[model samples]
Target: MSTIEKAMEQLNRSPGNAESVKPKLQTDELSTKVKIATAYSEKIEDKEVSVSHKKQKTLFIDDARLKSLGMISLNASMSERLVRDEFRVIKQKLLKNAFGVNRQETLANNLVMVSSANPNEGKTFISINLALSIASEQDKTVLLIDADVLSPSIDECLDLGEQAGLIDYLSGEIDDVGDIIYPTSVPDLRIMPAGRAHHMSYELLSSDRMLALMQELANRYSDRIIVLDCPPLLGVVETVTLSNLIGQAVIVVEQNKTKISDVKQAVALLNSDMNIGFIVNKAVHKAGYGYGYGYGYGYGYGSKGKNK
Candidate 1:
């Protein structure tokens, strides 16, 4: 048997203990170094789980609610002109990094994540808005995944009803990831809610199942962009584990809110090899300072969006 086949066989036969079952990374040959408890074996079977082939469930989003959140205009053209312009610039950088330009290959560009040093820093707000903008792209599709299993807010933000989500599939409550991925009323945009919070959420996120699911998402569609709204980088074990599965990381820092020392620590949690960037959530729109025509929030893009 080939080396990969033998490794798979060994993985399947071993007790599901975190130490015994090491899942291979989807993007690279190395395995995850995060130690995950093996109790998930009861949920995961020997057979491989396929996500790309399955049909997904569809959910409707409330446009009015999104408008109230300043996400989009009533006419559905990005609500705040300033917000839209800023995000346009941000997404441009991200897309170029994802698809590459002029034959230059971008590394770990498709799988992008939005995180922060702490809660209430507007990471969720930025994540949802970024997904919305990316969905507007002509050729690309976007999947916004709520990786914050501890305190999920995507469903609530989108005004969605209770539904089975990522946790259900990871815990084996559902056999297919397509069942958990919900296509939204918004065209070209889909979402995966955090689902029922599991006590072993951290472990499950770092498990073989999680790795398999991420691999499927990353490789299934060449033009697909996954925007993960992960938990805070510091003080969250799950976020650090989830970071290993993605290619690029966008750290959101609130102006005058998140401390500089905290931001440093949060960035340190991610793998050094990954491409990392920042987005200043709230900034004052002054006379100059790169501020364009008047808009909302005075949100500034600092040091490539590093807050002042």
Candidate 2:
């Protein structure tokens, strides 16, 4: 058996305990560490569990969640074209955006909205990729939920066919949320697909089941930073329902692409007291600072957005 296989078998034997899953990082094999994970960043901490390399609080994903045969959701594959030497720089910037907040108290308040004034605004790419970036960073756990029930992009991102996601839990069809959660190839990162498609996505999100599921996740995975990939606030009522679910929501706008009227309307709908942020995706800038390829971090309300 290969080393990875052996590790898997050990992991399966004692799945609940945090110690079983962490395999030692062989510093002898590689001088520079490729990744650094911690239980603190992800919000899971287990003291008894001690392992070499970066220590991460383990998760109890459904058996099928991590399975290979039917695994629908897959992470973006690393390409040879990427400059390996500078990859860490990109990851660092993403860490700042996903987790960075106004104050220590606001860190947990940094929620994101995966929306645009219209469809095809590159919201899904930003949502999923940002989630992945945070997960790949050491010790942080990111829960990517497909709140875009009207039209889900995670299905394509993970390439998983038909069924299993939030809709199931919301509609009273799925008994266990664990059954629907899929562990991506990336560590410290997991995804909950859009579940089965439903015509009334807005109704589903407002149901008792939906609220229960969110509460359960928040209570159990207190350390995790949950990112809900919601629908476009302009037309979808699902985004409004999600507003109550998350403390903060963000809208993704394509610069010079989305109509100003649409953005204004969406902002009004999401108005009043809730934490809202925007990511100016697909916008051209004169280059403020070369922080690699990903977008830089900006927390809370800013002049760059319509809020001011």
Candidate 3:
């Protein structure tokens, strides 16, 4: 069975019943080729540009990344417009709130782990896009990790080339996590895919090695922020484990789809107090978000420019 299929089987057996494990999950960086594939579309043919640049790789990534990457698509010009009109407005609010809440220092060190109460909550999409946005900012380095060992999303997102990563390192199949890390087209951004799922991979990360790895990562990238895209929290042990590792988390609640009951239960399951805010995902157009033009979030990268 493929890793995804195997993960499904494991989910059935585990059923997110284990008590919250200490240490947690969060997630991206990717190659230019990989990023274009993952961030753009699942279908290569969807891109009008010449795929002939197999060796061209990524020329460069935008300076600023985004939260809802899959929300809009356009030629480079259109994308830039989208970022200016849509992203900039909300981000200013995020920064102001961070400073106001006395979390000025915490937001800098935050290893935000994004997940939902269930699947298709746009957690994976949001997590990946957010990492891209962070990396774009000057002096800020961002690492996006596919910590969802049970069911990896980065590979699918980026059309990955690596055969192993987080799972291999945690299971002793690999020693150096560096071997698995891939740099994305975006400047200062890197990715660590949850290696192919093995037996009890959720349990595997709880081990001391995994804990050490996370600590090592935090120390190595003390200046950079890390984001984890994890399995849902309500019934997943790994998500709980991730919450414990990082003092902060962001629960992605998809509008309309997620039930309030599950959200309450998942929060109860998590023992961490780090959740800074609730990232409302897949939300419909609500007022107060001053996007002069309405963004129909039919919901669902990179370095070199300024906010001007």
Candidate 4:
């Protein structure tokens, strides 16, 4: 069976009626190719086009390097195949929620934040994989942002060199939004590494400048999706502050690790304006059932401290 079929089969086993998930699920039918606007500068006719949001910088990434890190396979292998298919299922759901007919009314539904209640629960793992999976799409582009200023991992995971990011733009260290965005060798995938750490990260993330940046990102290209790797919700004030600005949230709960109370507390901190969802990470795959990471749908855009 295809990945979506496997996912549907898995969801059918849930307590809620299986029919409820049919509308939310979608196959990988790519729409017509959309023109990709550059986020960085690109030369045309040898004359600088005044850097009109058309920035394209390169970050070399190897498929071998990625697989070594236990990420989804871009090539071929049983384990790699399974992981890739798994994320395909996950990303399809996310994309539907962002652009589906019944998508949430949030203005910035394309802006998604992937976070967890505690550290080391594989939140980063899921974030990176999700970005990669989305990038593989024929009709979409992705920006994997490292919003975890204090403990960013996107750069390190991809073996990128030191670079400026969201903080640099918000703090006035950088003038152009294009300056911080780095395009990866992966087609349709770009990233913004966490810039130089600042003691006032929370203040800066919640600043008016940050809000404007989000607006620009949201209103830019319709096909562009921004995935943020945010800090753990319970301990970091930045996560809560940043949550208010996003239209969608994905809370990654490590199976058998994160406490139910902690997950509830973390979800409580998010703004209800978002379409919140859950990802059960690090679960063992059952034979014939495929890998078993559950997707839980939590009610309400703004949470109120309840677990699903």
The numbered model that scores best in TM-score is 4
Query: What is candidate 1's lDDT per residue for 1-308, written digit by digit as tens?
Result: 42223322332343322223222211222211222223433333353765655676678887766655656432555324445555666677667657865312424458888998898777788888889888888999999999888888888877787889888899999987778888888899999999997899877777778866776676678898999998888888767867766767777766556776786677667765555656655433333222222222222111211222
- Least lDDT summed over 10 consecutive residues: which range in candidate 4? 32-41
Candidate 4 per-residue lDDT, tens place, 69-157, comes to 65765684763455566677777766876777866543667888999889877778788888988999999999988988888877776
Off by over 4 Å in 2: 1-111, 283-300, 303-308
lDDT of 1: 0.66
Could you estimate the TM-score for every candidate? 0.74, 0.60, 0.63, 0.75
Cα RMSD (angstroms) for every candidate in the order listed = 14.6, 17.0, 16.7, 9.7
Q: Which model, 2 or 4, shows the larger lDDT?
A: 4
Reference-based lDDT, each prediction? 0.66, 0.50, 0.51, 0.66
List ranges where model 4 is wrong by over 4 Å. Answer: 1-51, 104-106, 283-308
Worst 10 residues of 3 by lDDT: 299-308
Clashing pairs in 1: 73-79, 302-305, 302-306
Among residues 3 or more apart in sequence or in different chains, the pairs in candidate 4 whose N, CA or C atoms overlap within 3 Å are: 38-53, 38-54, 38-55, 39-55, 40-54, 40-55, 41-55, 271-302, 272-301, 272-302
Q: Is candidate 1 or 2 superior in TM-score?
A: 1
- Report the Cα lDDT for candidate 3: 0.51
